[model samples]
Target: MRYAQVFYISIYLLAVSFKDVLCIVDPVSLSIGAGVGLGALYGFNFMKDQTYCRVTECCNERSIPGNIGNLRDMLQKRLYGQHIVKQQLISALEAHFNPRISSRKPLVMSFHGTPGTGKNFVAEMIAEALYEKGTKSRFVHKYMGRLDFSVEKNVHIYNQRIYRDVVEGITECPRSLFIFDEVDKMPPGVFESLASLVDYNALPNKLDGSKAIFIFLSNLAGVQISDQLAKMLKNGELRENIKLSAFEQILEKASYNLDGGLKKAGLIEQHVIDHYIPFLPLEKKHVYQCTSAEFMKWERYPHKQVIEAMLQEVITYDRAHGLFSTSGCKTIEKKVATEVWIEKQSV
Candidate 1:
């Protein structure tokens, strides 16, 4: 409603400026009418071509590996804080549409987490689940990392439109899950355009009155730092009585560990920590520590047994070479050494 009013006012101003040249009369009425007309057109056009699923389930049942129950279970177990997160996501999607039995609603979900924390895998599992639910929906999208861009050419090679198309493709399916993997990779220049899709009023998707929920999976940790840290730095210093907590180091390391080693080179000012949303460092295990076995298995399979044998070898290596901590050895185990040993063997 506010946007419509603003739109008309802008039109009126432009009309008034050119009124003498164009010889227009009743410019205010014309502008107001046009604004309403456009808004109605946008809404009606969206409704006329609006897409919906013919069934409550996806079409490709045989080809999709898992069932809805399995997918739900996987989501519950794998995604930490599963119950509330799942409900919140579902409710958010549901609010956009009517409660119908037919499955044609397109679901767009964004999952955000740290690097190597299984964002892609979770997407795949969700796709498989939606497929089993009897919708023709599949995990049709893919990863587009920084390497995809051509810096010298200066060409804006973007995949967001491609992702948008993938969602549009499943209009006939019951529940389509369009997963934009590593969404944070969308270039800084294109962020505003992307933001439009997320913002309710500015949505570029006027078509289909899309029942599809847009899932944007990102590493929230990354977003939080990039969006926040700097503004908090202007303050003088931490108070003498206040303690400098480990949360500062965690944010610092997280920023540093991002791709391209850019974050690693950047320094976090102490004043920012003192003034901003500072608290305790998360005492959680590192991603690599939790998924060491998974990484090792993915790397070499049965040879992983032999690699497991190298736990002592690598701990000794770390301690002797000052490569890592003795305590870190417990978390990394032989899996870490196996990764290095395998690389050496390959070389």
Candidate 2:
């Protein structure tokens, strides 16, 4: 519209100048000026339309290639101690990419766990696997629930913003991925606003987000999840025997019982989500595995004494019911890096 207005003004100015010169020129010259003015107007309009079309096509056509096998391999390599997470994620991707499925709703997934349990890490890995730029891809957007919905009264405003952002993002890239972190802190209304977008029904808003992915990460069901794990451990059960399906109902119930964003939004009641994958708490061994991986990534030679000493300094374990990293493996990398630097300085 703005360009059209500019083109019209330019044409009008040219006509006025041509008319003024007509009085001082011959009939042939006047005809020539009129012809030249029409040609310029036509050229300008053609350029305007072509430029607009090119810009729109570019925005709508940008997409990244995705591979299921590569994604699975990347998730396995980068994320440790979350075997169920990797398997479930692979399953979800397979179903999402199934050629026979005709659902209009986006692939909605919820990641439940305690802090530092690789919820966010796995989310990033998915993004990285699907796109070459990974989390840095323009199509991959990460939003924090706390920051996005900090104001209670202005939730409606935030909801509109969220909807607009998602729609606009999908419009630009149909294969876009949206990640909501700290979902436990999000308001219920915010998720409600997005329910329609995540539903299986075709969107009346004409936004085709079927190819997009929406991942919700929260610690809402962390305690219940951990309690379930603790009980299994108490019974002398191995971690490998802890299947996700066995306690899915318990996790769902716990999520609904909580006052967190998912419960408030009635996501559980609506069953809008396709998967509710739980991230188990990191054991002391898992933390050690994370530390060892970080040490290798940093090219630090693993010294048993130094590693054990560093673990003691960085890890806070419970004595009563065996050892678990309360912070999960969140701080292990930095702690390991610092320890390695100290060891180098000492040498």
Which candidate number would show the highest TM-score if scored against the true structure?
Answer: 2
TM-score for candidate 2: 0.79
- For model 2, the local distance difference test gives 0.77
In model 2, state the lDDT of residue 108: 88
Candidates' lDDT values, in order?
Answer: 0.40, 0.77
Alpha-carbon TM-score of each model against the true structure? 0.40, 0.79
Candidate 1 residues 126-227, lDDT tens each?
Answer: 555545432334434444545442232332344355435543654444233444444345433322233333333323444342434444444535334322
Worst 10 residues of 1 by lDDT: 274-283
Q: Model 1's lDDT to the true fold?
A: 0.40
Per-model C-alpha RMSD: 15.2, 9.1
